[model samples]
Target: MKAIHIDRFVSNVTDLKPSTIPNPFSKSSQDIHIKITHAAVTHVDLLYAQGLHQNNRRHVQPPFILGTEYAGVVTHSPPSSSFPPGTRVFGGGLGAYAEQICVSEPTIRRVPSQWTNAEACAVGASGAVSYGALISVAQLKAGETVVVLGASGGLGVVAVQIAKAVGARVIAVVGGKEKAEVVRGVGADEVVDYRQEGWEARVKALGNGGEGVDVVYDGIGAVESGIRCLRYRGRLVVVGFAARGGKMENLKVNKILLKGVAVFGYRFGEDSRRDPQRTKDVWDGFMNLVEDGKIRPVIYKEDYWGLEAVSRALEDVRERKAWGRAVIRVCEVEEDTTEQKARL
Candidate 1:
């Protein structure tokens, strides 16, 4: 089977190459085999390729596949498994940039018939992360005000829409005019260009009575600014550190203490691993929003057509040329359009 193999970490994503690696091996009987048809390109993929991601620094060595999330068809399953062979599913796992993957049955979810391969693949863990941060962890409420950092990225777009879907006013903070436009199209009530000076003041002014926002979803590691944007007893959920180049940021505990705010570090993968059932509930509820057209995975417009384009796709994300989720069509398949048009 063909895959983007990382035999050893390199300094540049361009140095990675495709290899005909052996078929994936299943670790247990509960693991089902999938034939990957589409996969999403993410900043994590870029970091992982260059050995800059935390997993790389701590434990994950090379001689592994490069991608993290995918949509595919089940080719083999254990007896009486709910996901029988031929079921269409989308999920996250290592080695997703390959022709095939083997993951635990509990980890996969059935793809909605109305969803396109691109959208399904693009979803990856963004929905789960947004759901966990906004709904589960932060307990964001309707009629509240929330500020979403990195609002144009895949996960941030989902967070913006989820906040709107729950009847919250969203102040989306992005780096430029293009990203600001992207967030607005997804239902942001207000867009703040962080590249502009005084953006923090602007966000605070838009919040309740010019006090501060009810919640801050900080996926970009702008911890200090996020705390400043929060209202009294506001919730700040730290999702990622993409803007910090994957490096964790130091927070001012005095700011948090003075504001009487609650700070949370949300790791969707770790949370899911620790509490699988609760994670499934969150994911299932999030999918209900997608099925009802309340939320959709925001996919980048450019078409990356094959596995060979994986490097180019990563570069596109790294360059911020593809604002939303960038996906690669590993293998083409006819999509069902019977229910409704795909929310691309």
Candidate 2:
């Protein structure tokens, strides 16, 4: 199997590339063998490559494969498995940037029939976290207003879409006009350019009765500003610190206290690890949204082809050049001829 092999953590993405490794296969009844067709490129991948991600560094040393989420076709599975051979599946696990992966059945889910491999892979971990934050953790409801920080980025874009899917009016906070347009195209009712002064005020004005929003989905660690944009008793879900270069924010509790808002720290992967059934339930809800045509993966416009483009994909994401989720198309979709022709 060919994979983005990391022999050691390096500061530069150029040091990373694909290398041939032993193919992973189903070793037990619990395992499923998959032929990966596409995978997501994420900031966490870059962080892991640079040895900057604390949790990954603590558990996984060098000489491992890169990537966390992938969409692939099942080639082998035990008879007891729900995902039999030929099932189209997408999920998160280590070592996704490879031609093949072997994971336990519990970690994967069937890809919606309407989604292509590229689309499924593009949603991957970002979609999961976004859904978990907005629906599960924040308890966002229809008719409420929510502000999505860093709304043009991978995770933020998904958050914006999910908020809208649940009938919430979306105020997307981006850094530029182009990104504002990008989020608007994805169903955001309002767009606030964070580069502009008083952007938080602008976001607040878009809320109900020009007061404040019902929820603030914070992926950028703009703690004080996010609190400012929230209504009294609003919910704030912290998903990441992307805009601050992955640094944890020192939040002032005065605003949280004075505003009477609820602050929830959303760690989707950790929560999933702690309660697998909850993760399954989240996926079930996400799938319902997918089936209803209320949500879709927003793939970055650039096409990254094959394992050779892995380095380039990593570089693009690191430079903040991708508007949505950047994905590596590992291979052409190998659906049955009838379905392929129908899709064409």
Candidate 3:
């Protein structure tokens, strides 16, 4: 099977190569064999390719497939599982950029019939994290005011919609006017461009003259910008540090203490492992939201550049040039013979 492997860490995007390695699942347990239809490229994938996230213990070495989200149909599974063959599903956790993947059953979720493959692929990891963060971690309540920083990126878009669905008034912060518009379209009650002068003041002005928001979901650790916008006793959930070179160095403890606010570091993977049932519940709720049309996943672009474009996709995400989620169509799946499948 074809796959994109990071043979070495390099500053340039062209360093990645597409190679034809043996299909990964051929030697694994026959209980799972997923034909990868759509694999979404994330900023994390880019950091892994450049070896930046390696130092932070986020990624392992090269010669590894570099993706974490995907949507595809099941081509094979053990008969003991409830999911039958040819099930349309979306699963994400580890590597997903190859033509085929072998995943544990717990990692997969059945896609709603109403959702297209593109929509499912776009929602893959981001939707799950958004659900866990807004609904579970923050415990956001109806009629409360919330601020979503980095409100135009993949996870940001999902977070905005999920917050709105939970009945919160959303204040979105983006990098530019175009992104602000995107945030607004996704149901953010107000939009602010962080690049503009006095953007925090504008955010303050929106919250009834000088009052601040009840909750702040900050994906971008833009230091003082996030701290300045929060109301006293407000909860700030740190989902990621996308804006500050994927690092949070400038945050001041004094500001947090002075505000008497509660801050929580949200790592979805850890949360999922600790509370698997809760994670499954969140995924089910998200699927219901999709079925009811309360939320929609925004997919900016789809590229089937075979395996060769993986590096370019990673760079696009890292540069923030690709808006929303950028997905790569990996391979198509066909039905296996009933007799052959039964043996598994």
Candidate 4:
């Protein structure tokens, strides 16, 4: 089996290399062996490479497998699990950028027939976060106005479509004109170029006559200038800090007091770990929406880079060149003998 491993803390993109190792899951305690079909490269992967996410890497050692999102077929399953062997599923795991993976039953979810491998891979991390933010954190309601910052990136794109699917009027704040168009295409009612002058004011203008939005889903953090855009009694859900090196601006305590606004900081992984049932419910609801055609995963591109291309894929996501999700085709699974013979 082949996989990509980080030799050391990579300061730049060129530092990554490919290596050959034994198949990761062949010796695992779990019953299922997943032939990893697709693995999505994410900004989080880059952060890990640069040592920016050191706190997160504390438990995991070096020469570690880096990807978190994957979709593939199950070659085996424990009797206690609901999924049978040969089932197609998508889910998040600790290390996914390899030829094969062995995941515990609890972390996997069956992929619907209507979804392609690329779409399922794209939804792995971003979709779950968006669902948690909207359904659990904000408790969003129909017809409310929602603002999504960094609306062109992987997670933001999913958030925009999900908000619209829930009947919210969405205002998207993107980095440039090109990204604004991308956000608009994803069903945001209005798009603002946050790089332009007066972009914050423009967001207010689109709101209830310079008042503000009902909910602000800010993933970009500092770059979007989030604090100034909230309405009286508005809810701000902080999802990520994509804008690196930016300062966390102080919020005016009096403003919160006068406006009755609330700020909620969220980390989806923590929520999933603390309340597994809620996380499962969120995924189930999102799956239903995908089946109903109310929300579709926006896949930017697929990079079929055998196992060696993992470094380049991670760099592409880090530099912000990859728009939605950048997926790597890992390995192919052989058809189950019983199923194949039955078809004949």
Model 3 lDDT at residue 192: 85
Q: Please say which candidate is ahead in TM-score: 1 or 4.
A: 1
TM-score of model 3 vs. true structure: 0.90
Which candidate gets the maximum TM-score versus the true structure? 2
**Cα deviation of 70, candidate 4, in Å:** 0.7
Q: Could you tally the backbone clashes for each prediction?
A: 0, 0, 0, 0
Worst 10 residues of 2 by lDDT: 335-344
Q: What is the Cα-based lDDT of residue 256 in candidate 1?
A: 88
Give the runs in model 1 whose Cα sits over 4 Å from its true position: 57-59, 334-344
Model 2, range 251-284, lDDT digits (tens) per residue? Answer: 7788888999999998887788798888778878
For residues 96-115, could you state the per-residue lDDT of candidate 4 as single tens digits? 77777787787888876777
lDDT of 3 by residue, 185-286 (tens): 889898888788998878866764477887888887664676678778878888887877856576668998998888877787777779878878888877
What is candidate 1's lDDT per residue for 25-91, written digit by digit as tens?
Answer: 9899788999888999987888888888777866567878989999988889999789988778898
State the lDDT at 236 in candidate 3.
80
**Model 2 steric clash total:** 0
How do all models score by TM-score?
0.94, 0.94, 0.90, 0.90
Please list all clashing residue pairs in model 1, or write none if there are none.
Answer: none
The order by descending TM-score is 2, 1, 3, 4
Error of 3 at 133 (Å): 1.5
Number of residue pairs clashing in candidate 1, backbone atoms closer than 3 angstroms, sequence gap of 3 or more or interchain:
0
